[model samples]
Each structure stands twice: as C-alpha cells, then as structure tokens.
Target: MISVEGILFAAALFCCALATAGYLISLLVRRVALAKISTWILAAGFMLLTLNLLVAAVHWTGWSSFGSRHFLSIYAWVIAGIYLGLQLKTKTRLLGAFIAPFILLFLIAAAGQGADRNLVPSQWQGGLTTLHLVLAIAGEALFVLASAAGAMLLIQNNLLKNKKPGPLGRLLPSLGDLDQINHFGLLWGFPLLTLGMIGGAVYAAFVWGGSWPADPKVVWSFAVWVFYGFLLHQRLAIGWKGSRMAVLSCLGLIVFLLSALGIRFCLATVHNFI
Candidate 1:
C-alpha cells in the first residue's frame, strides 16, 4: 500500500512533468492553446503539492516533520498559488512557461531534502512555534511571488523598450498590472515579515540562552529584513516603479531563497535541524 505522501508527491511530480512538457511543446508548435493547457496542468501540480504537505502535517506534526524543510515544499505550492491568483486578473499564459519549470525544479529539490522528523526545534513545541512557522511561510510566499512578478515585468519591459516582442514577451501580463502586484507584495509582505522576524527572534531568545545570535538563521533573517527595508523605503519615498522596483524584488528573492534554503540546507546553518 502506498502512503499518502508518496501518492501526493507522485501526483505532483507527474503534473509538473506534464506541464513542463506541454510548455516545451508549445515552444516548438507555437500554439497558444497549448500554453493555456500548461497553466491548468501547473495548477493541478500545485494542488498535489499542497495535499502532500497537508498529509505530512497530519501524520508528522507530532514528530516535528512540519518545520523548516517543509517550507521548501510549501514554497513551490505558494508560487503556484500566486500564479493562479494572477490568472484572475489577466489572460497571460507565458508566465507558466518560466514559473512551471521553476516550480518543478524546487519540488525536485524538496524531494531530495525530503522529510525531517528530527528537524523540528525542541524549544518550539508550544503554540507560538506554530504561529511563527505559519506566518513566516505565508510572508515568505508573498515576498517571493512579488519578486517573481518583478522579474517577469523586467523581462517584459526590456522587450517593449527594444521594440521586439517574442513568445516570452507576449505571454506576460501587462507591465502596469505586474507593477501593481509587485506593490501589493511589498506593502503586505514586509509587515508580515516584520511580525515573523519579531516572533522568531523572541522564540530564539527563549530557547538559545541569552545569546541572540546563536543561530546563523538569525543573521540571514536580519539580512533579509534589511534588504527588504531598503526596498520598501525606496518604493515609498523615491516613487520608483516598473523595472527598477522589479529589480529590487528580484534581488530580495535572491537573498531570501539563499537565506531560506541555501543557508539552511547546503550551508548547514542553525536552522538546518529546525
């Protein structure tokens, strides 16, 4: 008998694989309908990934399987969710081209990271830990989605400025709409992040003795906060818009993913076990 996690992950892998194949097919065939189909397939993949996490939460929460590593899996779903959210406002399918493959890559990496029953922080057993983890994930999702939108906008803008429009250019939403989403992301994502940082710091201080910097997680989190701070300040005070703002969001995610995943896993940071 197959476990729920295996079934869900298998379903997700299949969906993402199909979506990527369809997008790649569209590239050769140049069929607009194929691109639309890819979007729906990608959404299905996202649904499967979310179900995988839900099953894991039910079965592994007691064993501490829902912490940091799970965040990477959730990140893939969150990216898909954000793309779906954008669909309500636009008819662009080009995004699925880049986004679907990116998500596929993340989930594959997530599979390698796998489940970490022992990764849950011993000190975070109470309800506050749940709050911290949940908010931190939700916040990270928004910021990363915003960053992706910014990147899309930059790609679209350059194509327009240079008077050359191709498949990628035609597939993106209007620059104006993406810019608005980017603004929404920064405006909302920053506050949630602030709350996350505060909650995490307090949690850390309680668990790791009096030393506030006991974890490399602390350093990365602080760096992310400061980077976003500069982004927010520039957006509000300097009237920055379009490509410039998108670049900021792009840079933020680079630092953010590094802090969130790269540092935690590859570098074996303090949060590696958590």
Candidate 2:
C-alpha cells in the first residue's frame, strides 16, 4: 500500500507536471490566461512539495529527509519556492517556460530514485549540517533560476538577432528583465554559496578532524564555486552582459549539473550522505 508521504509525492509530481504542461502551452499559444493558470498550478505544486517535505521531516529529523534520492526532491521544492517568490516580486511569469522544465527534471529524477533513509551519522547531526545544507540548497536554487533566465535570454537573443519576434519569442520576458534575473541570481547566490561552503568546512573539521577530505564532491563543488566566482568577477568588473553572460551562465549550469550529479554516480565520495 502507498503511504501518506507517497501519496503526497505523487500529488506533487502530478501538479508539477500539469504546471509544466500549462507553461509550455502558454509559450506556444501566447496566452496570458494560460500563463496565469500555469502560475497558480505551479504554486499549488510548490505547496504540495512543501507538505511532502514537512511530512518527511516530521517522521524523521527536519534535515534528515535529504537522502540521496530525496535530496533532489527537496532541491526541486527549493527551486519552486524560490521561483514563486521571485515571480511574485518581479512579476515575470514568462520565466515559467524555462523554470518549470527544470523542476520537472528534478522531480522525475526523484521519482526514479524512490525514497530512502538519510544516512547522517549521529555525531554529524546538528546546527552545522543544517545551516550548511540550507544555505547550499538555497544558493543552488538561485543558480537554477539564473540558468533558466540565461536559457530564456539565449532564446530571445536568437529570435531578436534574426529580426523575428515570433509567437514564442513574444511570449518570453524582455531581454532586459531576463538579464536582471541573471544578474540578481549571481549577486545573491554567490555569497550564500560561499557561506555554505565555509559552513561545510567547519562541520567537517568538527566531525572528521580535517577540513579538506579530498572527496570528489568537495573538489567538484570547489571547482563550481571558483568558476562562478570568475563569472561574477567578469560580470561585475569587466561589465560582461548580453550573449556572453548568457552563454557563461548556461555553461555554469552544466558544470553544476556534473558536480551535483556526476560525482554521485561516477565516483565514490564521503559526501554521499546526500
């Protein structure tokens, strides 16, 4: 028999799927009504995802729900929550076309991986891990938004360069707005990620008596941080924007994907706790 958590997970998936479909249709059909419907549906999906996480946390430790598989699910939840909040503040419903698919990808991965128990050691559980994870996930969620914006920017750029504001292009957010999202994402995500990495180092020193574990995840994570740091420097100091910024953002997302997922599948690491 399916458990309550399972039911909630299923419902969340269904809602997110519907939201993605609605957003995709909105892009194709050029309809504000459809975009509004998609926004509400996405909001419902985010709420259900939140409930599912809450239920899992209640059954265990609040942070313990972040097992290998379930962690991606939580990441999806974070992305949705962040996107919804940003959508409200920025009123950029058109970003759903790019963002919704990312949520779906994470959700589908979660569904495939199924549920699993968190493997956090007793000695490792506390405020340190919680802070590290929360900050890191929040940072990554912002990167998710940035990547979405970068994608939309590329699409819009292509259409504009061709002097064809096609129906789909017409449905996209303005180039300026998308660039702002990209800029804001980098501006906010960098500091949080830096703090989170520092927190992780501190936690490692406390638990394992060493700061650097030479773990694959840790190494790749550092690389991702450095790459983004360089990107930020270029954007801020060098005033890079337009296609270059968009391309780099897209490339950054690719590196992030490999760092986040590739290490999990391809290499053994001490960071496998999630």
Candidate 3:
C-alpha cells in the first residue's frame, strides 16, 4: 500500500510530467493558450509537492533523516514556487518550457535517492543549518529563473537578429521583461545567498573550527559566491543589460552547475550529503 507521502509524491510527479509536456507542446506548436493552461497545471503540482513535503517533515525525526532526496525535493519545490510567484509580476509563461524540465529533473533525481538515509548528520543539525539550506536553495532557485530568462532572451535575440522572428518570437516575452526578470533574480539572489553563506560559515566555525575554509566544498561555494557577486555587480553598477548580460547569466549558471557536479562527485567534502 502506498503511503500518503508516496501518493502525494506520485501525484505531483504526474502533474509535473503532464505540465512539462504541455509547456513543450506550447513552445513547439506556438500555442500560447496551452502554455497558460500548463501554468495552472504546474501550479497544481507545486501545491501537491508542498503538501508532500509537509507530510514528509512529520516523519523526519529531527534533521537526521533529511537525506539527499529531501534536499532535492525541496530544491525542486523552491524552483517551482519561485517561478510561479514570478508569473504574477512578469509575462514569462512561455519560459516554462525551459523551467519545467529542470523541476522535473530535480524531482526525478530526488526519486532515485535513498529516502531514509541521513544527509545532514547528527552533529550538524540545527536551526542555523536549516536556515542555510533554505536560503541557499531559494537563492539558487532564483538563479535558475535568471538563467532560464537569459536563455530565452538569447533565442529571441537570435530570431530578431536574423529578421526571421516567426510565430514563436511573437509568443515570447519582451526582451525588457526578460532582462527585468534576470535583474530581479540577480538583485535578490545575491543577498540571500550571501546571508546563507554567512550562516553556513558561522555554523562551520563552531563545528569545524579554523580548517573549515579549506574544505573543497567550502572553497568552491565561496568561488561560486564570488562569481555570483560579480555578475550582480556588473548588472547593477556597470549598467549591463540585454544580450550581453543574458549570455553571462547563462554562462554563469552552466559553469556553476558543472563545477558543482564535479565538486560533489569528485572531491572529498563534508557536504557530501548534497
């Protein structure tokens, strides 16, 4: 018999899968109406996932049972939630074609992980650690949105440059709107990530003392933070926008993602749970 959590997870996954198909179809066939419908379907999946997480939390005996599965589940949830929230203020519904696949991928990854395995460890479980995870995941979710918007901007720009913006170009969001989403993402994501890192650093000081900074995960995280900061700085101070900023945003996300995979799998680090 399937548990309530399992039922919710399965239901949410189904919704996301259907929504992904809908969004992809909307993009391929230039059906804006279908994309709008897909948005509601994706929203349903997000709500179901929210309930699933709450139910899972009830069984979590402290943070010790919080495994990589839980982490990825929450990560996917944040991404979905943020993307849906942005829809209220931006007309980037078509961009769901880019975003839904990622949400689906994270959920699929979560499904493959050991649900009961401990990821945070006993010694590191606390309010500060929780804050670090939440804030960092939220920040990263925004970055994902920024990259999606940036990616779309690139496609739209390419179509415009070639003077062949077919029906799809008309369906895409305005370049200004895309750039604004990218700006909002960088502006808010940077501060949240910085605060999350500070919390992590404080916790590390208490747990790992002077040697924490030397850890490969810590080092890579700091480097990513620095790179993220530079992108934010360029956007705000240097007045960068349009295709250039869009290109950099896509590049930043790709490099950060690739290096993150390398660090997680290849390096010896205390953050192995993630």
Best by lDDT: 3
The Cα local distance difference test for each model comes to: 0.76, 0.85, 0.90
Residue-level lDDT of model 2, residues 1-274, one tens digit each, is: 7878888888999999999999888888888678789999999988888888788887875545557556778789888988898888886798987899999998987887647666465568788887888789888888878888998899999999999988878778889999999999898998999999999899898777864667888888898899888889999999999778989988999988877778878888877744
Root-mean-square deviation of every model: 2.7, 2.1, 1.2
Question: What lDDT is obtained when candidate 1 is compared to the true structure?
Answer: 0.76
**Order by TM-score, highest first:** 3, 2, 1
Best by TM-score: 3
User: The CA-based lDDT of model 2 is what?
Assistant: 0.85
Candidate 3 wrong stretches, greater than 4 Å: none
* Residue 180 of model 1, lDDT score: 84
What TM-score does model 1 achieve against the real structure? 0.86
TM-score of each: 0.86, 0.91, 0.97
lDDT by residue (151-241, candidate 3, tens digit) is 9999999999999898989999988899998898888989999999999999999988899998887887788889889998888899889
The alpha-carbon lDDT assigned to residue 143 of candidate 2 equals: 85
